[model samples]
Target chain A: MSRAALLVLADGRFPAGGHAHSGGAEPAVAEGRIRDADSLAAFCRGRLHTAGFTAAALVAAAPHGLDPLALDEAADARTPSPALRATARKLGRQMMRAARATWPGPDLDALARARPRGAHQPVVLGLTARSAGLGPEDAAHCVAYETVSGPATAVVRLLSLDPFHATAVLARLAPELDRVAEQAAEAARQQIDALPAASAPLLDITAEAHAAWPVRLFAS
Target chain B: MSVHARARLRAEPDGRGSTALPVLESAGPLALRRTRSPRPPYARVTVVGAMSAPLNGDRLAIEAEVAAGARLTVDAAAATVALPGPRPDADPSTYTVNLTVGEGAALHWLPEQLVSAHGSRLHQTTRVQLAATARLLLREEQILGRHGEPTGALTTRLTVHRAGRPLLDQQLTYGPDAPAGWDGPAVLAGHRAVGQLLLADPSFEDAPLPARLLGPTAALTPLAGPAVLVTAVAADARLLRGILDDAMRELLDGLKA
Candidate 1:
């Protein structure tokens, strides 16, 4: 099942340009909504239920041997924010680069060629998981976990939380991860052939506002 | 003043009851009071106004106003579910809401959720006018029916304009007679609750707190010019409400800062 490969893909330090992005932490920190560890934890939890749920559900539901381009388009539609779309594409590109180097496959190559403009991270992650022989449920877990962990880790770096404390925060999030992953898995099972839809207007507005800031730490 | 279907109920005198009270009352038309806050740079203000009318098959027209530099957010306590008339060949139930926001003012047009029951047909129209510098955070959510309950057909038309130019013009039609079309990717995607929040001429680049607090589910999208759109969609009403509350707090905080 290439557990090592999956870990590498999910690692925060995979050099997929995640380090430069706070997944909205930089802006939120500047705004003072997330000032400490407790606030950060609460914020991450909210994200997991909303955006994280949407992305993981889609990745988990992608049909076996599904076309990556179609998956990418669906992910793009689900993401209404242009700034977020750009960030997802950037992260996707870097992840694809890493995947091509670690586990080269014809399907991956086909998916890469199919996305001439850009690819979304969830789409690439799903393809990479399938290429590594991981099941849909596992793929969904990895996607959901990474989605939350990426921002949590970014908060640690941004807020200067002790590394140990950050780990603890991630540990506390384990139950939520399991719950959301189970929901994603069930959604995938129920609608394996269907596409994904997320129409969140407020999030898109914030993303748009964040992008125009002259100075910002996160890519999104 | 035009007369439509009208019915009034006065308090009945009870022999055993000590206090005299009016059980129910029906007015000539839906009584609507519009007030604007006397202040400058008012980001958003919300006012909820509703009246109970008899089930006397009348179409009510409501004119709501939000004065300049004053914001208003309106919503009913519950869905104004319309029922079929006594006669088989009766006119459908309809309600029209006219909204106006003055210059340099912001209005958040968020209404309570809507629920349509079986054999019910409703038509609603919302018209919004925004000033050049004024902003609007408007949203509407609708649920077809209660779980395991029958749902009737419903149609909604929305028109939004800024400086007399159309910003949004769309129509949504759904009902029992209509084909089950929510399962597709372009539609609800099997989601029971659907909501849309629109922010006009907002400072998109200035949302750091909400971006950080909301994390992944909440994102900001840059539109042409100075407008931005923030969105978050969830499976249930609770999650949706939470997201909306967080987003509003962040936005209000941003304005204060």
Candidate 2:
């Protein structure tokens, strides 16, 4: 497995439409649920286990040369929020574009052709990892980190919370991220149907509510 | 004990342009089916039950299909409350609903609350298939428990398909033990009552409903088919219902044919 490949996939700057979403932080912040780094850390932790874990399992499962279409359905079945689903497809499309340009493989090309509108982001991310010669653990780490990074990054802009503190929050979560990544990868090694179905209804609810907002920094 | 209801409505030409009525298919606990048209262009189907405790081994299945150019509305007369069965290790009550709407057909399935009693569980799955021009307004309202009671487990899944393509697929699992779902800022936010509404029609805009007026707790998501979705949660059921109604009105402009 290429360690550098992991870096490229995990980098928030890789441009997969991650910049536009708040990971449900905007609602939490709006509701005053995530006002500071402490609260933000709490929000990220909850998501990391629920949505984060679910996404990681999908991502981790993607590179095992499994069926992406079925994985896409699993991803859809796992996500209950329509806004989040839209965001996933939008980001999936963007990631597909970038992944095709970067890796240029049959796996990536086939998925892009099968889902012209785009597959789910986690499914695409995992396939991209396979193209990059990264393993399931790498895929899990990439998605698990993103589960928190996307929120931490958005919270900084939404609340004008100190960037340093937000960065610290991400740093403090590194250990938890590792644990979640391992758990997701382990789950992926099981039957695809038996993969983690962990969900956060509050996030699903808030994301649905946030999508209706006339003006918001994030698309979801 | 097990109980279930199934009904289907089809609209055909009435010698005018189009005024076909429903073709019904119902059985079992559904024997209590009642209908009264409040106005033209739509008829109402009220599903009710006798004083009942949906305990272990109880099953409720409702299947409704609307044929081409027809219109139908479904409403439940009362809440379906699930209680502990006569036996201690009773299985969860199962509520499975399947719906199909033909081209240019409209079906509104607005059911009442589904209350899960203490130490009981409810597993529900709703599957909907729509023709290219079908319009669907479906609402799934749920309360974890009665006022001042601990919430029970309800694992619900919804899947919608149009022209053989999957439009929306989602699963929601909530109870005391379902992991980081109920307590987070992203979900219930500590509130109890939750209402979900799905409206699919051409006039509906593919954007969030302008519903900040509804309350910060309420939200809307516009899907690719320009379908509209609203989910609101609060400790108060009335408030959640109000938010859902406002959202529906915003999407269909009073939901008139």
Candidate 3:
């Protein structure tokens, strides 16, 4: 697998439709839970270990050449919120579309056919990693970074928080992010049932509330 | 001491809900009761204390089954306070629930508040299986401690399956002494009390979801399994309950058929 594949998959600007979602910072921001750059960092950190960690593990598991259908189910069971589930599948559909155009493979085509609506994003991400000839660890890193980066970037727009401070927060979290991605890849090697189920209740809760917002920057 | 309670419900020939008398053991720490809602098509089973017994080292199991086309609702008569056993470090008490909702049936399990007392521990697991056509509206809430003191330990695991498809499978374990569990933002970010409501139906995906959850203290997550999972947390009990009830009302508003 080319190292560049990871950069492509991990890049935020990729047409994955991640730009519309806040990773659940909007409600917290609206409620005054996230006041500034520092609080934004704190929110991202919490999401990293919980949902980020879980997404990393799920993404890692997808490239294992295992049953993608079962992985999809595992993702569904692990995800407690319907809104997040819809976002995952929607992002997954977009990823499938983009990944097929860029990487073109039977695995991607079959998944698209089976889940015409879309599979969970992490599952699609892992399979996309496979299409790109990337390994489980590479996929894990992609999701682990995505779990936080989506919000770190969103809060800058939502709160007009300092972009440099947000980037610094991600920079400071680099070490922990590496640790989580590594741990997630290891967990993915276990039975699909054994994959991490760690979640941020606040994220789920906020995503649900955010989905109802008539006027919002993000789709989630 | 060990205690067990069982309730079974089935639809009658006239399409009304009927249930056998609840089965309970008199020599245990828990008692069971069944009641009519004073309204048609609604029934409730309540779990109450049989006697003043120490909850430490106690095991209580509640089992309920809803037959095809029937419905049943389970509720706790009052808040259950878990008291420490002779040894504070002893194993926590356990409350296990096993429920099955048959084809075209529904079950509403709304347990009251569960408070984990200082020096006390509680572990509860609720496993529910629903037929593809069945529906479930489940709500769970807990307070970290009785007064201001920190709770000893509390763990909750819930899983729901539709036909052979798994809808939700997750667990949460918390203790005040454990700095790693709740100190992180995802678990609570520092709040003690937590509440969750899950409404899963085959028609859920196309169904209209609540415009907003009850308060600022909570948020909801959407599941790919055609279900909506709502969660909230707060340091105060009243606030947490209010948040949960608000979420619950939204989920049940137009969905109940």
Q: What order do candidates take by DockQ, descending?
A: 3, 2, 1
User: How well is each residue in A112-207 modelled by candidate 2, as lDDT tens digits?
Assistant: 899999899999999999999998988999999999998999998999989999999999999889988898888898866667776665787677
**Local distance difference test, per candidate?**
0.58, 0.77, 0.76
Docking class of 2: acceptable
lDDT string for model 2 (B45-150, tens) is 7776654746656777777777777777888878878776676666777778888888888888888887876677778788899888888999977787888888
Position A163, candidate 3: lDDT? 89
**Model 3 TM-score (2 dp):** 0.81
How good is model 2 by TM-score? 0.78
C-alpha lDDT (0 to 100) for residue A215 of candidate 2: 94
Per-model DockQ: 0.06, 0.33, 0.37
TM-score for each predicted model, relative to the true structure = 0.52, 0.78, 0.81
What is the DockQ of the complex in model 1? 0.06
Per-residue alpha-carbon lDDT of candidate 1 for residues A141-209, written as tens digits (9 for 90 to 100): 887787667667777777887778777877998888888777776776553223323232333445556
The per-residue C-alpha lDDT of model 3 at residue A123 equals 90
Q: Which candidate wins on lDDT?
A: 2
